[model samples]
Every structure is written in C-alpha cells, then in structure tokens.
Target chain A: MTQSPSAAMESLSVALGERTYPIHIGAGLLDDPGCLLPYLAGRQVMIVTNATVAPHYLDRLRHTLSGADLEVCEVILPDGEATKTLASVERIWDALLAAGFNRRCTLVALGGGVIGDMAGYAAASYQRGVAFIQVPTTLLAQVDSSVGGKTGVNHPRGKNMIGAFWQPRAVLIDTQTLATLPERELSAGLAEVIKYGLIWDAAFLDWLEREMPALRALDAAAIRHAIRRSCEIKAEIVAEDETEQGVRALLNLGHTFGHAIEAHQGYGNWLHGEAVGAGMAMAAALSAERGWLTGAEVERIGAVLAAAGLPRVAPAAMGVDDFLERMRLDKKNLDSRLRLILLEALGRAAIHDDTDPAMLERLIERFPRA
Target chain B: MTQSPSAAMESLSVALGERTYPIHIGAGLLDDPGCLLPYLAGRQVMIVTNATVAPHYLDRLRHTLSGADLEVCEVILPDGEATKTLASVERIWDALLAAGFNRRCTLVALGGGVIGDMAGYAAASYQRGVAFIQVPTTLLAQVDSSVGGKTGVNHPRGKNMIGAFWQPRAVLIDTQTLATLPERELSAGLAEVIKYGLIWDAAFLDWLEREMPALRALDAAAIRHAIRRSCEIKAEIVAEDETEQGVRALLNLGHTFGHAIEAHQGYGNWLHGEAVGAGMAMAAALSAERGWLTGAEVERIGAVLAAAGLPRVAPAAMGVDDFLERMRLDKKNLDSRLRLILLEALGRAAIHDDTDPAMLERLIERFPRA
Candidate 1:
C-alpha cells in the first residue's frame, strides 16, 4: 500500500502446457496499443462487451486498435448474469458469421465475468475454435474468471452448466477500470480478494486485516497489491492443475453454495460475488462445526468479510433443504455425493465430501437474515 | 476381403500425443456391451441417435446396456444433414440438463454423421465438455468423422461453421450396421473411402477398384476391409496433424468444392458424400488443367467415382459464381484468399492457393449438368 499506483505493471503466467497465457496487470495498460496488438494473430478482431461497459471504454479500445490493417467490430450485450444464455451466445455466433469472421479472427472480451465467459465460450466453439483475448473489467473478473480459462454460460438448472475449457491468448487486466465500478460491485469483488487470503495465504489475511480501510477506500496501491497477489496465488494453483482434476477444485471454496444462491435468487437479483461472500460465511460456519477451524478463527474470517460490507447471513427464505437439492446438481459432485471446499484453518482450505447432512442443516439455520 | 468378418476386430490408435484415442472396427460390436462398457467412465449414458437408426438398433443397445448400475437415456433427432444445426444442438443441451447430466455423463453417438457431429459438439460444450464415445453407425462416420475428434453443427452460411475440436474417449465402428444403410448412402460412403486412396494410397485405390462390386453390395468382408483401411489412413493423417495446420488439410481433398455444393444445394438435397464425389471430380479436372495430373489419370479417377454411382457433374443450377462464393466461405481460407486441396498425382495431394481463377472458371464450365 506504500507504493504509487503506476509504479510498474506486473505480469503473471498460467503454466498450462500448450495453452499457457500471460496476465498483465497495471493502471492505464489499455491506453497503450502495444499491450493489445501483439496478441492479434490476424487483422479481424471483435470486441464483445455489455451496454454498461461499451460507452465507457469501447471507444478508447477502438481508438487503440485504429490501425489501417485491423478491422474491428463490437457486439454489445445486455448487462447482467441473466444475459449469459445460449440465445445470447447465438447472437454472437450469428454476428461473427454474418461479418464473415473465420478461424483466423480473434474475439476480445472486454467486460465482467459474464462477458468473458460468454465471449470465450463463443470463441471456443465458433468454427471449432478461434483465438480470443480477455480485457476483464470488473475486479471479480480481473482476479478470478479471466485468468483460469473457464468459459461458459449458465443453464436454468445451474450456473456455468454449459461451457468449454478454452484458454485466451492473453488476459490484459487494466486495474484503472475499477474507477468506474459501482460501490456494491467493488465490495463484491473484495469478497474474492478476501478469499485468496482465507484459502491460501494466512499471512495475507493479516495484511488485509490491518489495511481493510485502505482497500475499502479504493487506494490504488492497496488495490494493486490485492489484485497482483490474488492473481499470483491463483496462478500457482492453476499451474498445478489446469482442469480441476485435483487441487484446482480448492478454488471453488464458496462457489458450489454460491452458485446455488445465484440460481435460487434468479441470477441477477444478487451479484455473483455477493452470493459467494455470503456462501463463504456459511462454509466458515460449517468448517467450525466440522472441527476443522476453531470458533474464533471462523469469527475472524467473518469479521473481515463483514468489514468489506459483504452479507453476513444467507437469505432467510432459503432453507437447508433448498441448498441440499441445489448442491446435488453441482459439477464437483461425484455421482450423487456432494463435495465442498471448507477451511481447515484460518488460511488453509480442503475439499470435503463427508459432511453430515444433519450438521449442514443446523449450520444453514444459524445464518438467519436477521 | 480374404479373412472372415468375425475372426477378430482391428483396432487403430490416433496418435495425438495426450489427446490420443483408439478406433475399434468390428462386426456385431454393438451386440456386445463389453465393447462399450469399458469406455463409460460413469454410470450415466445418453445415446444420441436419429429416427432412421433408432428403430433398428436402440432396443438392442439398451438390452446390451441393461445393467442396474447404468442409467441410459436417448435423444433421437430427425435423420438428415439438415438436422445438423444450432437449433438441433440446443435441443440436445436442454435434454441433457433436464435429465440431470453433469460433467461425468458420457454421451454415446449412435447413428450417422449428423448424429455423431451434433452429439459430439453437444458433449464438447455440455458443462465445458464431458467424456464421449463414438459408436458410428454409418460407413461415412465410422471411417471419417468418428475417427477424428472434429465435432460441430452446420451454420446456415457454411458447413460445420460452429464447433470445437474436442476428442472422444474412444470410437466404436460396427461393420454390421452397414447392413441397414440404404443403397444410395452406401454408395455415398464409398466416396470418402475412395478419397483416402486417391489422396494417400495408390495401392488401396487399386484394391477399391477391384472390390467396388463387393463393397457396393455391402459384402461383410469387403465392408470390414474398406472401413479398416479408411480408418487406418485417416488415423495416420490425424496423428500427423490433429488440427489441420499442415498435413491434415490434405484430408479435405474434395471437401472445398464439396462443402460449397452442400451449402449451395441447401445441405440435404445432395448427400455429403455425393457432393464430395462430384467435388472430387471437379478437383481432379482442376488438377489436370493445372498440369499436375495427366488427362488420362483424371479420367481414371472420374471412372471410379462414376462406378460408385456418384454424380459426374456439378448441379446445373449452380453456376461457377455460386461455387466461387461458397468455396470462399470454406474453413480452409486464410483471410479472403481461397486455398484448395488438389491432386499432384494419383495417391498424392497438395494444398494450393495459387490456382488461376480464369482456369477455375473454365474448369467449372466443363461440368454442365446436361
């Protein structure tokens, strides 16, 4: 938090075998064409964004890409999670084909996680795959979805129920975009930032505890440290396991329950990071009950999430039975057994599949809206 | 043709480094559940078939898969090249979600090329991909589409214009399924069988010339030989180039013109093989005009395709301009320059981007429908 915001750009690489890509993080990175031009293998590029994002940044992106050789197009989608559907993806497909985009074309996803997932999946499946780059705008996207190459859309039954593991050519995260982020979203994104500290770096948790005010106030130095460090932790885990065959599942700390909440609340009602914030609280409560974490450790984790203005309880209308039914549909479940990532301690997390249902029911009851 | 059909099944492996898979060709393979059970990594299996192929084999496949441990379901699509569309794929997505299919569910494609492509694409995108096995029932699929992991749906603008290069766990080709293939389809399948010979194997071309009668009659031994040899040739090329960067493009010898014909004729009017058959003739004519193949050699190749009842000329309604427009839309194109696969000589093919347009126009005019 002591350094200036524009000190120097940091680059991290996800070490997937052939699909390895770099994540570039800094302030005002988007102002430089050098950051984008090298990734374009061809002259045709399509920028995909949403109504909320296009007016703010699409013109600048177009200006940066205004070379005579480059033919750039944009497809603006409606903002929100509800818009991440097969029908919306089909619009992208039709737009690309109608514009005569082929395998040589590259799609640029320039918005939040929904746009990245939708555009990435479109790029993955378009003509058996084309090249794509990610310019993730939201904090949640910059640190999480944009890096791992997990691209997909939600099904009525579940979130991210249809997708492909297609990696982007590169992920360019310009932290300056956070200036335009809404307050609710800023706090929502902080939930994931807190998650990195909780799940992998206990020492970082202490840093966040001390600098909670700086982070909540959107101090550029504090934001940069949080994003770069969060990305580094994620990169190491992804390098170890790209496709979630093993250790990668640890990244889903609150996601299984988070996805259930998002789906139950009708997608756009609650932001993804918000649900995850609340869901992480429930997991912490459950972890304490399982004897993996002390009651004091759980409270410490809760205090940090609360400090970031995240929800401290689950929705009162959602009962344990609803979560149980929804969780059964989780992609991580093996056969019919539910698997969850829970805190083993303040900074360590482990995937557990043997939690007693009765105990889970009691844990849910504890998180009343009041 | 000398060996007994049931003596033993032949297995060929596609050497794609980490994505390598086995192609198993045998008589009565679907009759034995053992051939399929090992490939099922999970208990849930969804058989994607077509109306034409289901009545003949669905019950037998179900009976064979009648273990209490396995949960089997079917999504039967209308049987035709026209059925390969984004709309059809949506039906598959909805069906899988409704049935509670997740990442572990294995999709078995149980019909012809259309079903295999549609179902394979479904498996590729369903929850970011799941394990899928190919049980190709058509000779075209058994030898070509099923062996290579190219799965997709046709866009209204082009054939296979939307897809992903997702590999299957294994491919099972049952020679007995050819017994139910219509005469026209059996002849159409021979077009691709002839392609392997024309593009790579001169001696196999000679063998196909000798066995043309037996193959047309659906003789079991001849069918088995043709499928095995075709699969072998395809496996070798695919092993060399899985994603068609260089050597794999050689496999699309007649496909550029063929795809144009398929697209121009509205996808189902002429079978894929029939269009390819005619397209190959056009390619041979173009190759000879370019002084690559002898005029006599061109006629020899034409006579073999003619022997299989393949059309000798492009449809009269399609003018040279129509062929040019459609071929420009081929996946092989780089930017807007057209690249095509042409014969250097019998059993040897090369990708050519410098074909003289005037010469191509003259060649098209030679193929009058009358």
Candidate 2:
C-alpha cells in the first residue's frame, strides 16, 4: 500500500490474507535482485518466456539472478496469441519435469499476457500448484493480466475457456520495458488504462485526457502513475472477489463484446486491449441506450479512446449475429441469461442480465462499424 | 459427522468452513434425489462417467435427477486409467461449452476415481471453477479418492502430475455400486481401507483384520462401516491441513513408493491401491529396518494386505534403480531430498527427508519380488 522508500519503486499488496503478494512498479525493478530473490519459493527457479521477449530480457534477468545459490532454468516458447494453448503450457511442464523442478520450485513469467497466463497455469497445475512470479514485459500485462491471478490457455471453443485463479508470489512491473513496446502495443495498453478511468474513476479519466500526449510519449512519471493506479484498482476489485462471484464481474465492462471480437477475428489479429477499446465503446453506447448515461457521456468516452489511439468502432466484417453467438458463450453468462457489464456512470459499472434481446439486437444493428 | 436419522444413510462433513460439504454413504444414494439436488449450483448438470459405468447406473442417476427443472447432459468417456488425460478433460469442457453451461453449473463425476479426478479438474478450471459433486462408484474412489478433493490426471511423466485441490460441493457414495465391482478392483479398494488403519487407528486395523472376509463378501453392514471410517479419517486429516503443508502428508504413507510402482507399471497395469498396498508393505519393512517398527509389525501389515488380496511384494521386473528414479520425481519430495511418509509405529506416520540413499537402495534391492 506504500512506496518502497529505498528506491523509486511503488509497492501494493493484493491482500488475500495468507496468499497476499506484492506488486512492485518502477523503472529498473527487474535489474534489482532484491525485488526478485526474496519471493523465490525455493532455490529452483524456472523462467518461462517467449522467443521475442527472451532475446531482450532473459539474459538481463539471468544476470541479476547469477549471484544466488539458485538452480535457474528457462523454457523459451514461440511468440504469439496463437501459441497460447495447452500444448505450449505442456512444453513448460516438460521443461520443469526435465529439470526435476519440484513443488518448492518457482516459475517466473517473463513476457506478455500469453506467456504469463500459460506460465501461471503451468505453475497452477504442475504438481498441483507451485509458487510463481510475474515479470510482465508488456504494458497490457503490467497493469492488468500480471496483477490479477487469472491464468489459463485458450480453448478452441473460447478464450481462457480453461484456467485457474492461481496468484503469483510477486508481480514486478518494469516501466522501462515499455520503451521497447511497439507504438500500437503501447496504444493497446492505454486502452486498459483508459478502462480503469471509465469503470472506476472519472477523476482518473480527466487526468488521462489531459496527459494523453505525455502517456503516448512514454513519459516516465506519467506511465508509472498510470500503471500504479490501474493495478491499485484491479487489486481492489480482485481482493473483494478472488473467484469473481460478485463485483469482479464489473471489471469485464467490455470483455463480453471484446472476447466475441477476439474470437470472431481469430485471436492475435486484434490485440486484446484493442478489442477491449472497441468493446468499451459499444458498452458505453449500449449504456446510453439504456438511459444510464447521456449521449454526451458516450461521446466523451469515445474521445478518450480516440485520444489513446484505440479503435472506437466495431470491425466491419463482424455481424450482429456474430456478436450474439459469441457473447452467449461468455463465462460470465448464467442460467442461459446474458450477463453484461454496463456503464452506470462515467466512473461506475453495473452487471445486468435482464437486457432485452430485441433491444440488444437493435443496438448492434444500428451500431457503427469500422 | 452424524448419520442421517431419516434414512438408512450415514452423513459426514469435510469441514472447510464456507466450502464445507457432506459425504453421504448408503445402499442406494444414487437413487435418492435428496442426496444430490440441494448441492446443484444451478439448473445445469453435466454427468461425466465412463462406458463401463453408464450402462449400469446412468439411467438410474438420470431418473433420480429427473422430475426437476434441470438441464441434464452427459459425457461418457472410455474406461481405464489411460483415458485419464487432458484430452478427456477437454472433451468434458467442450461439452460444457457446447451445452452453453455457465459459472453456476455443477459437474457430476459419476464413475470411479478416474472420472472423479478428471471431472473435478474440469470443474476446477471450467470457467475458472464451478461446483462439482463426486459420486464415486468404485471402492477405491468411495473410500479414498472421492473424499479428499485431490482431483487431477496422470501426466506422461508421472501419476497425478497435473491437478488441483479443488473440493467438491458434496460426495455421494453408494455402496450398492460395489456389488458390480470386479473381485480384483474390490481388493484394490481394500488396500486404501487398510491404509487408514495403519496410519491413524490401531483399533480400525484390528477391526479390519477381523472383518476382511465379511468385507470381501460384500456384507452390507461391514462395507458401510469401512467406508464411513475411511471417510472420517480422510475428512479429519483434510480439515487439519487442506493442502499437503504438514500433517496431511501422513495420508500419503505409502504414496511415494506407490506412485513409483504406478508410474513404472504404467498406471492402469497395477491399480493405484494395489501399488499402494505393496508400497505400504515396503514402508513397513523399511520402518522395521530403521527400528521404528518391529519385524512382527511389518509382518502384520503384509498379512492384512494379503488378506485384502493386495500385492505384498514389489513387481518382479522393478530393480532398485527403477524405484529410485521414479521416486525421486515424486511431487512430495522437496529440495532435492526424498520426503517419505514412514511409520513411526503402527497407526502413526511421520515425514522423513533424511533417509540415506544407500539404505533406501539396499531396502529396495532386498524387497521381495512378486
């Protein structure tokens, strides 16, 4: 809940009582052994990353871990959302088994959401469960996926159709990593940053509107503040509902439509945050239709998304039926009813399962396409 | 903890606070809707069984589940431990998704240990976890695997190498199902029954020694008592330590050696309980060698296993190196040291990681061959 006084790092705890872990955010945090070593469950550490990320940060991480009496090993996997499958996770398990890594061993996820999700799952199911650390190199992962314990691989039927809520021992977010992140990817990450504002804090939305250029420029201070705020909001939501029984559903304000978009386009075609950007715009529009928000409020939401360089319209190739078919299969749905997270206000979200089918159809039918 | 006064069934709870659920043991629990309906998370129910089990009990289970506003579906997998793989679980997930089942759905594992383990893992990861009910039909499942919530599948590298400690909503054990169990399978279940006595209760051991013939004969009252006591012991240990952090390791008294045998013999070749039976014998003999158990005490353990029709000797083809290699990869081992659950005295077990390799090697070398 407080910043680590010794360094420029800010630390927050996802308070799960016994499983409570720290999220450390700062530049050069990955270069500091102090941030990584203490959380290692044992001397056996398995670093799971992708070929793309491995070339950039794996050696630096290995160098930082050199002085310890640790038995460090790594499994570099192919890069892409398509690679986020059980087969890739099996490679991780194979590596752990080949290395004779035991229950006491810790798995370090050293890439983006795909690597973190797959690696975390590998930790969750390997020998039942083991300790894991998230070293998210991408901004999307740093502020979102890496902080929460939602770990899994894609099922052919759905995204994250199979996974476990297995938390990491620590999450180390190196803000410096964003320097190497593609501009489009940076814009994608900002989609989630904008989401935190739209769902939980209008004041943060105001700040983002004013600081959009600074954020887009990769301003050090602006990025740290954004990452810290996003993680704090996510941690608060997750802490209240670790298994998503209640309020956690509100965090998925755009995920239902977003997941449908991802599935329709085939995952990786549109980055997750990119789809979420458009999905959130759809949700805002729907919320306005439901009289929860004004037309002006929906326009304001669109402005922030545009400022962040995120898509503000649905893909032209997708149809209303495509949206309906995919959204119906969302994990959030219950008892055959479609559960949607709608904007109750600029900074607040609500779960609604009673949305009339005809109204939803009209909304999608009239909605603008890319 | 008490038997149901209204019916001929006995009931016990695995007290995990808010996650607590009951285990009902009786002659025909599968025919009683009351035993199951209350725990269904929602109207959606997916019965996961095997070809061997569906013909005998599927209709009966459906009949019991009928007359309610339930959307019931079933996935019948092929029989055998070989079917206990991620592919089987994927089929279960695919069915749930195809049925459009949601977070509130409950999975019913309606077969033996394999079904229970795979289905439980399915429930654990399906939509990040849903409620599941275990209706274990086999004796091995009813007495051991069903109650503990140790759900998983065997990895190509090892037995139960991938899994979770996801507790079930309830466990229903109908002793009548055992009537159809093969003689060898019945004997396999008895191995676990004898294990509880050896690890926790001398009196239960004495009673089992006297009641072996009656149990083998499937005498209704004798079978019920064994299942109940076994459930009770397992429940107590699980409540004390839900995960294998401490005291719970004792429940795996013979599992380390047993898993080695299971892995070496290729899972289904030597039934789980049969391997555990012989493993328990090896443990007793090793305990005697360590002066923690007397020769007569070891002999008594072997006699009880023999009476249960379980193997008392290691497989003839397995040498010392085979056992060592497999045992070293066991999940229970920590820090590159072999952690074994050994008998300190009859009815009491202890975790030991300091066993001399030469000593263990000699014990395995001298162990009697089948």
Error of 2 at B92 (Å): 1.1
Query: Which digits, one per residue and each the tens of the lDDT, describe model 2 over residues A250-304?
Result: 8888999999999999999999999999999999999998999999999999998
- I-RMSD for candidate 2: 0.8
Q: In model 2 chain B, which range of ten residues has the least summed lDDT?
A: B1-10
DockQ (CA atoms), all models: 0.79, 0.82
Candidate 2 chain A worst ten-residue window by lDDT:
A1-10
Error of 1 at A209 (Å): 1.8
Cα lDDT of model 1 by residue, B233-343, tens digit: 999998888888899998898999999888888988999999999989999999998898998998889889988878868888888899998888788997877898999
Q: Best candidate, lDDT-wise? A: 2
